[model samples]
Target: MLETGQVISAENGQAQVHFKRTSACERCGACGMLANGQDMIVTLENTIEARPGDQVVVQMQTQGMLQASAIAYVIPLLLLIAGAVLGKLALAPLFAGVESDVVAAISGIALCALGFLGIHLLEPRLRRQKRFQLQMVSVHRAAQGREEEQIDKE
Candidate 1:
């Protein structure tokens, strides 16, 4: 996906870009959220030599986005279901006086929590992979008021 933003800082071949949360971003909070909920900051490889304060466009590989979404959404859900089923079938019998439903609920929640922890621990490694990285594509000049007026005139 392509995103447009202004470079907040750049160094060591990487840049932090400031972007307004767009429609796509609202639908996908994989990048997380900042305070006020309308702004986002992304750090990416400065492939085009983007400097701080420069307007630029960046692109993220589609495969990376899909993998992230699945890891974030699907794994936890599957774990919850699996845990519940296992707890109801095996664990509940092992716990005297515990209802199968209660055991299932607890097991499902605990397993989902573990899944989140696993994802957190795995974050640094996944982030280092190039497939998940974003690359700055090009820097663009900020439009001037006179330019807008001229374009409108035409």
Candidate 2:
């Protein structure tokens, strides 16, 4: 499932978010990581609404990650395979008297083009759907560590 959420705070290469999860998320790989209330750093790929201390709803799609990944990978491979089969069949008659290598070249080119098109369309959408839980919040109103500069010093 896809979720649109907000960043509550940022710290140490991570951001804490109060995200709403859908039923599909129960099967997510990341959900397993967050199962024990242990903090996990998730790579935030996209956000519809974001701000410090803002309420945001994450869009969660109900497909399990493995199934979703299979769909993403298998579809393109099928496209390439189909392209190769169709290419070979179409070129067979035209090159009936030509060398076998020449026919292979033609089919290879066709399959490559098919694969490229598949990758072009699928890769971006898959990446944009990524969302993860924040392991830690870095930003704070008051400094708790020595890194906190004294307001009076400056």
lDDT (C-alpha, whole model) for all candidates: 0.82, 0.48
Q: Which of the numbered candidates is closest to the native, going by highest TM-score? A: 1
Residue pairs with backbone atoms closer than 3 Å in model 1 (clashes): none
Specify the poorest-scoring 10-residue window by lDDT in model 1: 145-154
**Can you write out model 1's per-residue Cα lDDT over 22-104, one digit (the tens) per residue?**
88878676565679899988877777777776788777799998998899899999999999998999899999898889999
lDDT winner among the candidates?
A: 1
User: Candidate 2 lDDT, tens digit per residue, 1-154?
Assistant: 3443446665554445654544544444443244554333244422322335533333333344555555546665666666567656676667778865567566766776777687667756655553322222222223335453211101
In model 1, the runs with Cα more than 4 Å from the true position are 142-154
Model 2: how far residue 27 lies from native, Å: 18
Which runs in model 2 stand beyond 4 Å of their true positions? 1-42, 45-64, 100-109, 129-154
TM-scores, each model vs. reference: 0.86, 0.38
